[model samples]
Target: MPELPDVEGFRQVLLTCRGRRSVTDVDVRDAGVLRGVSEERLRKELEGRRLGKAWRHGKWLFVPTGDGPTLVFHFGMTGSLRCCDQEEPIEAHDRIVLTLGGERLLCYRDQRKLQGVRLADSADVDRILEGLGPDALAVDRDEFLELLSGRRGAVKSALMDQSVVAGLGNLLCDEILWRARVAPRTSTRSLSEKTLRRIHAAMGRVLATSVRDGCVPPRRSWLTGRRDDSEPVCPRCGTSMRSTRIAGRRTVWCPHCQN
Candidate 1:
């Protein structure tokens, strides 16, 4: 699934769509990629509108049209936004393509259309944002601690819950916990203030690095680097890494460090 870092990368892709370029065409190769708007309505609303500022919240990317509506994208599991040449051959997975100034092509490509694109006006955007928790990267330390204070569930689950803190996925949850030396099964309510501080700091560091790299980079020194090993070992202590289901997702943790 596309996480915060990945969506941030997509926001960068949307940057090219901004400025003076007008959308000359809106081609819907798969309407399944369209959430609420019909193909005709999408084309009608966007065919000649200029793209303005772009914003991202959690895993959602929003590109505002000068006309008022914003094009919101959620890159489900395998979805991606690719800026390519209009003359180039379209990939089989290209669900929607917007021709910009008849020069560039902003394509929404997805093999599994689990989550795709939606069109929203300013009021609708506010409503959608009202339901989401703060973006993990933008939340301040004090706010982060406050958010975690009420959760009694496993910390890992709380981390992955979009309503609790948006943008963290399975890999990010595991990586942050590993870096904080906190077990995935640790209850949120049991965490000391110091531990929560460590977790928040680790999350910020990890997100900064991952957002810069545009993915949860699997560097060898990080737990994510070895989580897929046949028999994974801790990067810090060389102890065998432990794995089990937590929050119904496979979790990897350093037993020695996190205990």
Candidate 2:
């Protein structure tokens, strides 16, 4: 699954590969990856327009064109943007391709096609983003505390709620809880002020590290780094790690480190 860190990495790819480049052609090999736009319209609206700027909000990536519309992308499970030469063979799963100057091609490839692309104007972007809460990476300590204080569900569940804080997925929610020494199933309303503060701090720290590394790297000292072992053990205390579903996603935590 592409989380905040993964989307941030994609934003970098877009900036480097397609920014300011003129779209010479828009080819939609699989229209299933498009929403509210047809193949002909996609080509008509996007082709020949210059990619003006690219920005990411939560899990969404927006690539705007000077011609008045922005290309929106959401990678549901296995979507990514790739840059390759025109001479290179088209990938089997490539759904959308934008041919650019210098023989460069920007491809939107997704195996599952769970989420796809859209064309939006500035007005449309505002409407789509109106319901989302402050980004997990951008929320302040006070805002995070206030948001967490009102939730009655498990801390892990609250963390994964997009309305509470956007951009945190299952892995990030569990990892942050483990780092903050809070159990995954702990009730959000039962948390103390100090614990909430620690959780907020940990969220920022983890996001920064993951974005810097271009992924949520599981280090030997980190629970994520060790959670996939045949017999995973807590890095801090040798106790076996636990795994279960919380908020409908596989959750991992160290019993010794958390709770």
Candidate 3:
């Protein structure tokens, strides 16, 4: 799945699509990747309109148009955006193509049509985004502590809950828990203030490193780096890592370290 860092990289791709670029054409190869708007509406709304700055919140990417509407993208499990020359051969997965300024083409590609593109006016965009919690990267330590305070779910579940803090996926939750030395099944209410602070710190560090690497990098030194090994060992303690399902997601933790 494309998480925060991957979506951030998509946002960078959008930077090349914006600023004085007029949409010359829109080819909808697969309408399954579009939500709430039909192919005709998409073409009518986009063609000839100039693209402005691009914005990203959590896993969602938004591109403002010269007209009022913004092109929004939610990269479900396997979705991405790319900018290519008009003559470049299109991939089979490239569902939507927006020819920009008669030179560059912006493509919306997805393997699983789980989440798709949406066109929303500013007010509609704000209303739609109101349901999402604060972006994980934007939330500070104090805010993170407050969000986790008094939560009843397991720490890993709480971290993966989009309503609690947007942008975290399975890998991020597990990595954060491992770094903080907290069991995935540990309850947030059971966590002490010191533990919460540790979690907050680990969250910051993990997000920074992942965002920099443009993925939850499975470096050899990190837990993710070793979790899939034949006999996964704790990267820090040299102990065998433990695995279980928390909130229906596979979670790996170090029993000795997290205990």
Question: Which candidate number maximizes lDDT?
Answer: 1
lDDT of 3 by residue, 111-222 (tens): 9999999999988789767867799999987898899988998988888888888899888888888899989899899999899889888988999999898888999889
By lDDT: ranked, best first: 1, 3, 2
Off by over 4 Å in 2: none
Q: Each model's TM-score?
A: 0.96, 0.96, 0.94
Which digits, one per residue and each the tens of the lDDT, describe model 1 over residues 37-112? 9999999999889887789999988888896589899999899998888679999999999999989999999999
Per-residue lDDT for 138-221 in model 2, tens only? Answer: 999999988887788899998887777889987788778888889999999999999999999999999999999877888988
In candidate 2, how many Å is residue 165 off?
1.0
Clashing pairs in 1: none
lDDT of each candidate versus the true structure = 0.91, 0.87, 0.88
The CA-based lDDT of model 1 is what?
0.91
Q: Among all windows of ten consecutive residues in candidate 2, which has the lowest summed lDDT?
A: 12-21
Worst 10 residues of 3 by lDDT: 11-20
Off by over 4 Å in 1: 17-20
RMSD of candidate 3 to true structure, Å: 1.5
How many clashes in each candidate? 0, 1, 0
Q: Candidate 3 local accuracy as lDDT?
A: 0.88
Candidate 3 residues lying further than 4 Å off, grouped into runs, are 17-20
Q: Between candidates 2 and 3, which one is better according to TM-score?
A: 2
**All predictions: root-mean-square deviation over Cα?**
1.3, 1.3, 1.5
